[model samples]
Target: MLNIQSGSTEFWRAWNHLLRPVSSRVETPRVKLSRRWKVLAVAAAAVLGVGGLPTAGAASAAGASPVHIRFSTGGATPPNEMEAAIFSPELQKKGILKGYDKDYTLSILTASKGTPQTLSLLAADQIDIGTLGFSTIALGQAKHAIKGGFSVVVAQFVDAHPGYGANAYMVLKNSGISGPADLKGKVIGTNQLGSASDIVLRAWLVNHKLDPRKDVQFVESGYATQQAALNSGRVALGTFVQPFEAMEQASGKAKILFTTAEATGETAAIAVVARNNFLKEHPKAVKSFLADWVAGLQWLAKPENRTEAIAIMSRITGTPTNVLGLVYGVKGKDYYRDLKGCPSAKALQNGIDAMVKVGDLKTRVDVSKLIDASYLPYPC
Candidate 1:
């Protein structure tokens, strides 16, 4: 469960508008592979039934009409319901595939990724479609894993701070902490190590001259555990996105400390990914999915649907309407688009660089290898 809050002040509003995403190249940690090793790997993988491998044509042809699929998503509710409401109907109406009503099994994949559990469940031929942060997808690609293609949803406006600042840092109102600097020496909570929120938050701390690892200890908490950690007085601050932050504040359980919108003007937090095998075999199905999904995104952006979208999201996530509303307002235009408006290349590269500086990434990663702009929903 996440905490949500009411409306924000004008300063918070103005701050969000100022910190937009920008493009500036910075040296990021890369995987240590000589050019020869890299070429050899690509070549070997190409010949060894890995890279450029095609999907099973017979299976795809067997299930042409409303193909059965298992689309995986994350835990956050607003994005979940918003995506569901938009995509499910559009997919069915467009004669694509079945998911929302019953044609497919939509699995909610937890954010935990490690030794065995990874987003590459697609490469392993487990799930057919899923969603992941662009940064996560990029990391997977650089590792020579996760054979998938992506469809970007550009998030145009981020009401919170920028440069990974899209997440909120909250404190209990009674804790007497009001600003970022006040968090010195306090215990803070993030989803986990290697999480986007963790990386960005650490960068914010570093910019402020605070040693995230030393000055403020970070604890790993899942979506459900984060709220519990904060309520138990075990954590002075907890990080979360949108509706959760608003809901917590509205309930008087927490206070707004700061948000990524307040730091960076642009931010992108979500993306839809299709497995390479499925995408290759069912090209038409994949295209249909993107078309419907784009329609869904457009519908969700409408002012008339805003309230209903928020309610649907609240119902799914168990967040309050007021809190959801606040979160929605802050997100602005980017709520409907892809990374161009939200998680720009500059911001993502910053994340890569931050992770490298913290020694989380083993080697330098070329940011370009992770993104595939060839799949943008427009210019079709």
Candidate 2:
């Protein structure tokens, strides 16, 4: 019976095409019915053999195979404005990456959950793709825990207030501190060992001719803890990003001491990484996801989209819209070219070398190969 029905459908379709007049198109009832029914039939078939549809450009490369991408990112909060609305949504549509439990299940993981968590997730194969801090990625590679797949978000060097930017140094307003040199014999704080703030602070200290080991004391602290520490006089100074620095000043606890850009004279930051085996196994899906992800960034970077983009980033990061707008810079001009080095290779290698020189790393690791720029759109 099913075969007979199918045969009849095909016969009618063919007959409809034959009877259709050429050079004299007419939307007669019969022609309309035929076209409508044909569309219905195709739709029905698509539901049954959904895999038969032509995948979009990127997906087309892999044929009809359903590629599963486990994606991750860093930062305590979800992607800022442009990312949630434009970036993540477009990528998830590929079905290669999907949201499970409000969290993306794409083989991607990020360092936002903290360095240790990121490493553990990758080591257990729970996450395949992740946005990682450059320092974290290098350290993980050294320990043989994970490797690079593609570079995602890059760090922009901004001299905005500390705590707003990721690598900021803070000091109390009344500490009588004027510059990096004033911090000598004073206490500074960061989240933990191997953090961006930790590494950048050391670099900053060395840049000012102070020894990180002796001239300054490194105190382990958190956002809330750092604010509290500064308030209670636990530490004379600290290093962190904005809002925290802004908040400290707002609350009359601390002031923006220095931004990483001031110390390094260049933008130094982090990137996304993939586990070795994961990258090898699912290279196609990786490329597709990135192509669309970069598209979203480009779209959001447009001048017309700036207002909405800032609102979105503010919503996600919980940073005030006013503050977010001021802090988040223009895309191509302020931020790194999409998927290109936010923290350029030269800067990252320099940072790593600085770390090694300060005895932060046992061996100087080569990071050039670690940055997979192929995932980004050409001319990035």
Candidate 3:
């Protein structure tokens, strides 16, 4: 159950928006998860990829409720890297994560919304840990207004390519729009108004000498609806991430514009974070979770486990095996961070600066101080 707290009204609005069931018809891409949680002997999982892992407190002798970390998936794919492993028979065999969940639980504990929502929950102590975007955290800090009560645990994911996010942009086939120049006076859609999609798109435009704010009409189009918006002619261009990006390109109905990698060399995924007090109070439990998560990453990253890994991801996202393999890079060399949980510091700092220069974020955040890497899977 969610115990929402006070925070920026902008975030509250987004929080409420994320609380809807999958069919809510919201403009945002964060669709709700299945409300019915499978009883895993542990706890319940929330709607739309809003799942939680129980902490060490779940041990019977301790007689305390488990630490509930409500995590969210913030991309176009099945946010199931760890979920695939944690809930699978592999992790089940080790029994390393079993202390918390008789069964893994899903929670709608306000962490599903976005950075602001996650921060608010952290500040209020409503949830212990959740997934967040580094850019969001950095931009919020730069503005010097985000609620302060959490520390970064690990880097969530990453995408590296010559022009991944930028080149991943999709325009309807035969739309007559060839490049960034065509979008100068037209509406271009992003998953969120101030997220990776928005910032990356703007940065790509700026690189082309187009002032995103002045030259184009930037609109908020949820990731789920981005494709529809394009087909319906609601927006001239729709930005996508991951499978959504790969899916659109595969559909042959759209064409790539350019590579967004030009702006930020690589795309960093969401991060795992926890309330400062909770992290300090129970370091072992946190480490166990990270260790288990990293173990999962390591298993799936290996070539031998490729088949099961694909099946696991397919089951988690309900995406097909073929699509998962293609977009997620099961066969290809799409390296996921194993023991190394944090992204390149330089890349993240540059991302923060890009957001600031584009006015997406008003302040400059010191990326160095924002992370508490001491608790990560490896030494920082």
Once model 3 is optimally superposed onto the true structure by TM-score, how far is the C-alpha of residue 134 displaced, in angstroms?
2.5
User: How do all models score by TM-score?
Assistant: 0.68, 0.66, 0.75
- How much lDDT does each candidate structure score? 0.52, 0.53, 0.58
Candidate 2 runs further than 4 Å off: 1-66, 76-113, 147-166, 223-232, 242-254, 330-343
**Candidate 2 at residue 15, lDDT?**
35
Ranking by lDDT: 3, 2, 1
Across residues 281-358, which tens digit of lDDT does each residue of candidate 1 receive? 655555555555555656566688778766766666677776667666344412434422223555455556666666
For TM-score, the strongest prediction is 3
Q: Alpha-carbon error at 260 in model 1, in Å? A: 2.0
Write down the TM-score for model 3: 0.75
By lDDT, the best candidate is 3
- Could you give candidate 2's per-residue lDDT for residues 227-320 as a string of tens digits? 7787677788765554454445556556677766666544345455666665566566666555555565565567786787667666555667
**Please, what are the lDDT tens digits per residue for candidate 3 over residues 1-380?**
23222223444444455445546735557533333222221132222223243332343226544444454433334432244344465555765454435322334333333455555544444456766666666754555433444676777665443322232577888889987788878988776766765677788788788998789897776565677888788888997765556557667788877645656666554566666766776676677666666666666666787777778766655657776577554422243443467645565666677786677766577776767877656776
The best-first sequence of candidates by TM-score reads 3, 1, 2
Clashes of 2: 23
lDDT (C-alpha) at residue 230 in model 3: 80
